[model samples]
Target: MSSVRSFVNLIRPSIFVHCEPIEDPCGPSATMADLN
Candidate 1:
């Protein structure tokens, strides 16, 4: 499960970049907080 999470984390940055124009709470920063 951790490996999957890590894999998702790797790809999330690109998605985050594309989604950055929106004021969404599911950004990388929020994800990191959730991960911790």
Candidate 2:
């Protein structure tokens, strides 16, 4: 169960980024390019 949850957690970020990439954090410095 724990492993399944971890796997879901791993895939979740990618799914979220695909859903809303602009809202996802890129790095230490946020870029306006993402907004554009």
Candidate 3:
């Protein structure tokens, strides 16, 4: 979702440097926590 993308974008320049570009591919519960 766009909301998830926005969250990832917010962190992309910092802690997310080594993260994948999967876009919440891991599902809602975990992704939601990570997004927050």
Candidate 4:
């Protein structure tokens, strides 16, 4: 179960990283071009 959680988090970060601009309205930092 712990391994599964770690795997989920690993994949999760990548998903969040790729979200970039689309998630911007939720936070000001989201508009930062450097995030892309």
Candidate 5:
């Protein structure tokens, strides 16, 4: 479960980068805060 979470964390940034302009209203920095 933790490994899966970590993998998701790794992949999320890439997706976030691509989708950020379209989907992320709060932006990557906010997402990073939530992740932590």
Candidate 6:
């Protein structure tokens, strides 16, 4: 899932903004709501 990789990349930076990596390993759904 290339999209998943991209998603991870995009969200990786946000890990600090939200400070919730494990709880929301999926990252901020808001960023990829359309894909989900």
Highest lDDT among the candidates is held by which one? 3
Determine which window of 10 residues in candidate 6 has minimal summed lDDT.
13-22
Position 36, candidate 6: lDDT: 52
Per-residue alpha-carbon lDDT of candidate 5 for residues 1-36, written as tens digits (9 for 90 to 100): 555556767988454321224257776666576665
Candidate 4 lDDT at 11 equals: 80
Where's the lowest-lDDT run of ten residues in candidate 4? 15-24
Which pairs in model 4 have colliding backbones? none
Shift in Å, residue 30, candidate 3: 17
Clashes found in each candidate (C-alpha, N, C closer than 3 A): 0, 0, 0, 0, 0, 0
lDDT of 3 at 19: 40
lDDT of 1 by residue, 1-36 (tens): 555556767988454222224365675666456655
* C-alpha positional error of residue 17 in candidate 3 after TM-score superposition, expressed in Å: 12
Write candidate 3's Cα lDDT for 1-36 as tens digits: 556667877977454433445556665566566665
- How many collisions between residues are there in candidate 2? 0
List TM-scores for all candidates, in order.
0.33, 0.33, 0.33, 0.33, 0.33, 0.33
lDDT of each: 0.54, 0.51, 0.59, 0.54, 0.55, 0.57
Off by over 4 Å in 5: 13-36
- Model 5 residue pairs with clashes: none
**CA RMSD for every model?**
11.7, 8.9, 8.0, 8.4, 11.0, 10.4
lDDT tens readout by residue for model 6, 1-36: 555656776979554332334356666685666865
After superposition, which runs of candidate 1 have C-alpha atoms over 4 Å from their true positions?
A: 13-36
| lDDT of model 2 at position 30 | 63
Number of the candidate with higher TM-score, 3 or 6: 3
